[model samples]
Target: MIEHKPLRLLRHLAWIPAIWIAWELLHYEQYKLLGNPGSVFLFTVLTDWLGFHGYEKAMRLGVGAMEIAASILVLIPRTQGFGGLFAMGVMSGAIFFHTVSPLGIDPYSDGGVLFKEACLTWAAGLLVAVLRRDQLVALFNRIAGRDAAVPA
Candidate 1:
């Protein structure tokens, strides 16, 4: 009995975005996001608009931590599905911010590189979700205590 090799490769690819995001976010023991006034202002506006007041630093830290955790999870075969789902959620928020907030598609004037990365990461997450669907189902079954036979 052999497993599908391409799906395994796709599942592994999901970790790439998580690692990149975590590096950009949690580098140097500090949150490196919003380095400029425009980025900060955009975040302030988005935070206020989203109705999450008085905890912007905490929010950034929390989100970064989530990315780091997802990065770790996706690298491990057993937790890849959970990690991919979590990373997708983070990427979705990013895409939404870049789309609707003052963040815009070209924030940081990086020729829309950040936005492109977010889109690519989102797409990779989708690939992981579809390629590892069975693993996700097995995870859910285990969580539900149904004792289903999960793949090795």
Candidate 2:
């Protein structure tokens, strides 16, 4: 199949956020991790601050796994839109936490770099979604099993 250059370029760019986020969460030892004290502390604080405690590890591991999955999916040509959608979801949560939770924009107290990265990633994912809109529409049409006529 002939590759569309613009879509292909966008697809490649979309992988940046996914891979960067997944790496931050997983560190190449995603599966082997069982929740570190740092992660536990952060999640604990998040839960307590948000009153969503009692599932700290689940939240951490679950989001991390999803981020990793989204990253992997973005690497494939056929699933770029799905991956972008998944990434947008994950980044949305991250941005929410950074804004609302005690985490603030500087969770690590570094200098808000993490928050900035989250924003960038979210924006990139959104861009990818927009660039791959045709694919998303096609998928939706397939799933809905009907072709809706587009108004000129």
Best by TM-score: 2
The CA lDDT at 31 in model 2 is 36
Per-candidate clashes come to: 0, 0
Give the CA lDDT, 0 to 100, for residue 108 in model 1: 68
Question: What tens digits encode model 1's per-residue C-alpha lDDT throughout 23-58?
Answer: 543452243354455545556666777888766666
Best by lDDT: 2
Please write out the lDDT profile of model 2 over residues 30-134, one tens digit for every residue: 432566676677777887887786977777777777877877765565776777787778889989988988878876778987678778777767776776677
Output the lDDT of residue 78, model 1. 73
| Regions of candidate 2 where Cα sits further than 4 Å from its true position | 1-34, 147-152
User: Candidate 1 — worst ten consecutive residues by lDDT sum?
Assistant: 25-34
Instruction: Estimate the TM-score of every prediction.
Output: 0.73, 0.77
